[model samples]
Target: MTSAAPHQSILDKPFVLDLFAGPGGLDVAGHSLDIPSLGIEWDRSACLTRYAAGLDTLHADVSAVRRDAFESLPPEINVLAGGPPCQTYSVAGKGAGRKALEEVKAYIERLMAGDSDETIDRDLKKLSDPRTAMVLEPLRYAIQATRSHNRQKRPYDVIVLEQVPAVEALWHHYAKVLETTGLPDGTKYEVVVDVLDTETYGVPQTRSRAVLIARRQGLGQPFLPEPTHLAYEAKDWNRRAERATSGVHQPTLDAEASAPEAAGPPKTDGVVLKPWKSMGEVLAAPVGTHPGRRTPFLVRSNYGSSGIPGRRGVRTDQQPAATVTGRISRFVVFEHLDERVVREGARFSMNEAGMLQSFPPDYPWSGTAQAQQVGNAVPPVFGAHLLSAALGLPTPDPEDLRKPWQPATVEHRAKLRSHGCGAGDACTARCPRPEDQAPARSSAVPRKKASVR
Candidate 1:
């Protein structure tokens, strides 16, 4: 269904409706490309952040919007975009989806077979984790949107969905069903699905995600954009971040270990890939102009605590970060005055975590759970490339990814601080953030703490 067909201008009247729009990640990407987007989120925390960023937001339920599509959504919405909840399918979370992969597939089939909303809702509750069923939400909307397209009424030009790589099989199911949608001259959702490397797209983290891009057949082939940066080579597990403070204590979670391998090597036709961005460079200064942060340091993850000899995760400034998560703040940075003398370890501030996820350094991070919101967000830089590919827009310039972003001055000093920590708590490597939901540390082996001020 893909081709090297001429591109058309979707900018003339583009309106995107992003479901599960956590912290406006994809919306940030959309706005960066001058595309108009409205993100619908049920989480009040996320919606608060969206309002802070000034991203058009609809604080409503996706399923309810599905029921009231015509009344809630405008007729000009051409793009349907979202990443459904993947808690059950995420390798890091419960294995419900994996345990019942066949059952999940069967559910997809049932949804395609025209099951009523009440029936599907009841069936979805049977799963241990209801999030597993949310994956089908996009499909439900697509099926309805395609019906509109068939009637040439408020037709959608494209639909894109993303989720954990473990959900790749589910997306393939989405592809087959959408391909047959609007058949015989209506909007055929010709799709391409695959896993994308975040670092390969200029993000300074090695996170991976499964993506599905579907364009109306009339718009020609919809290809995932070529990687703009070389993929990082994993270093030996024994490698340390240039400090003599402590020996190997825990094993990093190795989030990318479960990332579904791309079906084939990335297509390199007509594009040159640059070296992937480094943690030091991105944290140091805006690629082009800003010069506030001059001191580069090493980042030690709070992820891997699987106490094994020579098993640790240490990221040097020269390397890309492992994965940015809510607990990223717990990961301390060993400030290097020279190379041998290390200063007391300190964790990233709210803005620092945002930058690692490719959000503007000044992006307003409002409300609580700021770290989780930033961590869970789709890297805006990567999203820009994806939207460009899906919407027939010109590929974004590599420099644009590097350009200094306009700072968010939405009452910089007014937003609330950490979710649960007191303003005077003096959070450090040992701060047991009560608000975070990670499992408790293993009590058998005593852990070392970073020297704090």
Candidate 2:
């Protein structure tokens, strides 16, 4: 579906309504671009963090809200942006079973079919099952918004949605529904769907998400954001230079090309995207005796535990970090003095983790729930790229792609002093016992005292 292309200026200042706005990442990105936005989130801790950051927020369950309640919004709320909770749909989640997945699909089909509320409610049988049916909330709102325009009359210009790659098909279905359903004015949305790599957009973490961009009637075809960074797998500097100067537009080269085998042989000439930002660049301490130089370290999550060695735990300073999660504080790293490694380990402080997510340093974290907030947040840098793409605005300069690197200030350090400890306890590490000591002496290593002090 397509429409008359709207000018970039109409997109420049669209009022954005961010659903599932976890910690206001999308809003931060929107505000940075001077696009007015408000975040709606249910997590109190995340809401607190949003408040701390001064983001406009609605602290309510999105599923419970009604469209009429939002009628007071600015007449030009052109962009409806959000990433619904993906726990139920995420492959990493154990609850992602065939039945639940099918139910979500059925939910979308029914909603788009204009089933009565009672009929839809009856079909939602596993209401008690936490993971059941949350994925359809965006469709619910989209339908409600459409209904409102049909009645009270308010129309949105753009809709942007994202989720884990697992939910790509679901989004495709939603897009089809939106594209086919003309508004009372006999207009339809132009929908585009793609899975985007967060790393390709300069977020330090290599997270991938399914994205749906839809522009309301009279706007051009929705488009995915171009990557701003080179894939981490693009190791040939000479090739990078060649591509940088070629000015070629290569869509598949962004994420798919990151995998040499899957993407086939590398193209000597490709997109001009810059190299993926390394976790080290964001988390490593400068090494030297000088004023701005500090030692760096490695963090290992669940270091001493015995298990299947799950997907990833230990993160070295030089690589981009594994995805940040609520438990990101569990990933431990070594502290260094000068060039020597300190065996004692400490995980990323909330400030560092937030920085990795492209949140501002000293973002005024609240409560002890730092990791939870950081982990759930959409990386603001990636969010900014999404916003730019949705708004038809130019992407920010590469230099502006990430939070500026700066050493922690004394006050910042003080604020994060208690952040690295794991849930309900101080920091800990596993150290080898003396070789000759009895089994009794070989107990778990005493928890390491936090090194921040």
List TM-score per model, in order: 0.77, 0.72
Residue-wise C-alpha lDDT for candidate 1, range 1-453, written one tens digit per residue: 333445566547777889888888899888778888877776656666776676766555577667664344666777989987766664444655577556677876776677777887888788775556667777777666655643355457788888767778888877886687443224467899998887888888877788999887677678887677777655332333211224533222233431223444444554556667877768776443344455656666765533533434565566677678777767877776332355655678777777888887667687777877877788898888888888887766645545445533444312321221122212333222344423221101111221111
Over 1-453, each residue of candidate 2 has an lDDT whose tens digit, in order, gives 212244264454578888878777787787667778877766655655665566666655566554335554445666788887655554444554545676776777667667876777676764655445567776666666756643355456788887777778778877777788544344478889987778778888767778888878677666777766655542342244236447432111233233223254333234455557766666544322112213545455543322323422443454466566666777766654221344675556677777777776556676546777787777788888777777688775534534433334544333332231111122212111234211111101111111100
List the candidate 1 regions with Cα displacement exceeding 4 Å. 1-11, 68-70, 91-95, 146-152, 180-187, 236-267, 286-291, 305-311, 337-343, 398-453
Which residue pairs collide in model 2, if any? 230-274, 286-294, 298-333, 298-334, 299-332, 299-333, 300-332
Candidate 1, overall lDDT? 0.65
User: Best candidate, lDDT-wise?
Assistant: 1
Highest-TM-score candidate: 1
Model 1: pairs clashing at backbone N, Cα or C within 3 Å: 251-304, 252-304
lDDT per model vs. reference: 0.65, 0.60
